[model samples]
Target: MNDQNPPAERRLPPLQLLLVSLQHVLLMYGGAVAVPLIIGQAAGLSREEIALLINADLLVAGIATLVQSLGIGPAGIRMPVMMGASFAAVSSMVVMAGMPGVGLTGIFGATIAAGLFGLLIAPFVCKIVRFFPPLVTGTVITSIGLSLFPVAVNWAGGGSGATQFGALHYLGVATAVLVTILLINQFMRGFWVNVSVLIGMALGYVLAGMLGMVDLSGLAQTPGLQVVTPNHFGAPTFSLAPILSMCLVVVIIFVESAGMFLALGKITGETVDPQRLRRGLLCDAGATFFAGFMNTFTHSSFAQNIGLVQMTGVRSRYVTALAGVILISLSLLPKAAFLVASIPAAVLGGAGIAMFGMVAATGIKILQEADIADRRNQLLVAVSIGLGMVPVIRPEFFAHLPQWMEPITHSGIAVATISAVTLNLLFNVLGGTERSLLTGASH
Candidate 1:
């Protein structure tokens, strides 16, 4: 027999729980609202409609968070997890929203159908966990971090559309924010260290505010204590192409969520057996279902929060459950969500670099156990990383490809995942040493 303590999902004091949960919400808030903002623009929505989309997105995200953290029957995973709108689905949604036959209604229908598809496949995905060895998962995660760098750079440059793109002060603000987080983490202790990101963001917000950068326009329009109604975009109209596109994104979500879940288990000392894994995935699917009706995009687990979990050494699911409550409030009180969004892009960039960089570093740490020196593994890592960069390096490289393949080709994570899985199968599962050599020779 072995002796060890249970995972960190234990209860904390009510006030402490509330504060910690708020930290988690604050960390992911930028990412959670981003999808709706992007899609709203691509959909050519009015300013007011875009604001409503953000509100609905946060509201539904909160409900989904509760379902995942505080399980119900065969649904939630009951883990210390927070769910948010998926970035993976953004390109497809943008394309569909801009297309003539596929507007808001079509997007919803596809999202709903994709959710159902994900729900049915979650069990099968859980059973196939062997395919994702550390190498594959690490590559995908590293790609996630790498792909986000462009976003950070854009933010630091005062966003791509800024008249003064790459302005010196923008970089200065981002650097200052980054420094603040680093200093807090180094000197702070216990809970303070855990909330260094939040503290850094707060400092950055104040700094930017003094520089007259924070925009209150969104907040001025956002109403307080508003109710989000279902099908706010009208009845969802289903179409085959968009539904298929969304299904691709759902598959990507399954893979990324599994990687995140596995990594969190390692961090929190939780053994994510197949049963628990399936339940977690079901929550993802259910959240997607809820997102569709609630005028939002699909939801998935966030890796940055996982990094925060590791950094803070807090594993309590209850913390995240309370976070769900906070998100619900943000949803109901549009002003609250607007307040978070009003944070300057440069400020968010500084914190985002640290959060997303930690995610990539986590992947590197996991790779420490893998025998990467082996030729097969080396090649796997090499080619997988290369494939991942294709989309990030040249997003338009696949533009000439058929529209049907855009969802897969445009996503750096998806490209990496496919490359890793296929390479792993050939090198390990099929015992293709000779084949690898021949392929290497041809190259």
Candidate 2:
């Protein structure tokens, strides 16, 4: 009986597990913090208000990430996945913010409705997993990386088209941080190497502060212990138009999650069976609904963390669960959250370049598993990836397109998903006479 059930992998000592878990938290922190910062700024909130929003986002993200990784009953995928507010919902949110009578309440109402829509569709959406062979998944994952590259570049250059962009201090700080990460990876081994990003960021903050670049003035003004009392904004008010818009956003999220599920499957060497995919999507949808109720925005899997998971090869869902716990704790402590807030964006940019690149590399690995020798399959991958780049490279390319089309065109995920699914159907599902030489070799 003992031999029949071989012992599980030895659990690392508690300290070791905590350190590894911290690495996941560090890798995800910048992106997690950015979502709220961006949304608050765009919404024209005051500094104090923005700080409050940031804390709320972290609180919600932590809870959502935990729910995703730890799972409950049939609701979660129980993977080492982390969830956060999505950039995918940004454009629509900005649009909604401007609409008369819609305002924040409208956004909240729509998010709640959209999240429920996501929950309802989870089962049906999971069935499409079969259509996502490596070829299709590879293209979609690659598109995710391609889409995020501009974000990294913008941060590196002092953020999205800023007037003071390309300042000498920004470049110097970013370069130092990037070099620190590389040197740690090259020389440091084991756990220290795993937390290179975190260490590099700490170093960057000190260096930036010495140069009088880091701002501590905000810290003094920040509240010491501010609890995020729920219903901070009056009770949510619903509207048909806003709800409809949010539903569209939710549809895009499901499509993106489909591609992400396939990508995760390839990375983990685990099958994302219909059941697992269903649970994963439900967790994401349910999390978004939770965010709305908590006076936050939509939530989804943080694509950035997928790279960290692959790089460190720390595949335990427990590690991410621990991270979620830490995040929640931080959210409850305004002073502690402010400490993370002080980290310079340039420092974050350096780590982001490397992490995002790793995501692209994973996509490349998936492509290698694809049968590229098949000319027809080759054509499908090529076209899908190219179309996905349209929105990423020229974000405003579809600005002049119809208003109803805004939801889809503004999203690289939507573009990639549509192209991949359509082309896959054309080349694989239909099984038409137009066969490629490598078709038989694909499996």
Candidate 3:
């Protein structure tokens, strides 16, 4: 008889649940709002419109998270998953905006169509699970972590566009936050240890505030209560070209989301079979479709939160469900949203290092169980990791590529996933060695 416990039963107490959920909210809030901020600016929106975009993104993201973490029929993965705006769609949406007569309405129209495309393709996408044994999954997961480190470094340097970016004070603050998290992890126990990242971020925020680095001016301007209305940017007008572009973006999101789901499955000790994988992808598609009506961008699993799950050792899906509630509340209460948004980038950077690093570490741990000593397997790992770094180190490396191919080569995670899956097929499956290796690894 099986003795393992299901994910739903690993619930935390009420207070612990709230705190842990808040930590997740803090970790993901920056990324959740980033898409709308970028797209809003690209579309030449006013300050008020941008704020509306942010609120709408958060509201849809919260709903998506609930669908992802708490199962609704066959739609959700029923695991500790957090859904948010996908960065993969940004480039395409921006391009659509620049096209005459497209703009924000076209973006939303394409988003809706692409989401429906994703929903139709999700079952087929799940079939790719067979290609992702420990070998490919490890490489992809490791690539995800490596790809995110640059973002953390940029944050540690006082964010990308800061006037004083990379200043000594910013680095110092980030280092202090990193050290605080490390110290807490070492000396603390039980709940304290679990909340180390939260405490670290809180301290870093305070330190940055003391240094006059934190900005609170926006909070005063933000309204106390805001409603997220559908089609706030005007009625969506679909075009074939934009819809096709967004469909490509959805394909990339599916690949990245697959890697994240598998990584989370490894972290929580859950078996992500084809059925579970299908449900997760379906939720992503459903939320993205909903996002179009809600004045938001495409939705997918947030990779950083997956790292948080590994770091905190809190595997309860209910925790993430509570986080969904918190996100909904924040979306409705703009003042509180702005308050959390006021946390300095340097503070997030410190906590991010630990959270993102754990994802890479988990991949390494998984790799250790694979049959990597074989020369073919070794080459697969080496080549996959190397090619994956191309987009990360030089994002414009594929700028000259055909527009249709941009979706495949633009993202580090997408590149890594392609490399890993293709190489595994060439060196293992086609070479007739994958079965033995997988069988051995299973032992």
Best by the TM-score measure? 3
> Global lDDT of each model?
0.82, 0.78, 0.89
Worst 10 residues of 2 by lDDT: 1-10
**Candidate 1: worst 10 consecutive residues by lDDT?**
1-10
Scored by Cα lDDT, where does model 3 land? 0.89
- In the predicted model 1, the residue pairs found to clash are none
Show model 2 residue runs off by greater than 4 Å: 1-11, 41-44, 161-163, 432-443
Count backbone clashes in candidate 1. Answer: 0
Model 1 C-alpha RMSD vs. true structure (Å) is 4.1
TM-score, every prediction: 0.91, 0.91, 0.96
Which residue pairs come into collision in candidate 2? Answer: none
lDDT of 1 by residue, 34-94 (tens): 8999999999999888878888888878888888888888977777888999988898899
Which scores better on TM-score, 2 or 3?
Answer: 3
lDDT of 1 at 165: 79
Candidate with more favorable, higher TM-score: 1 or 3: 3
lDDT (C-alpha) at residue 243 in model 2: 80
TM-score of 2: 0.91
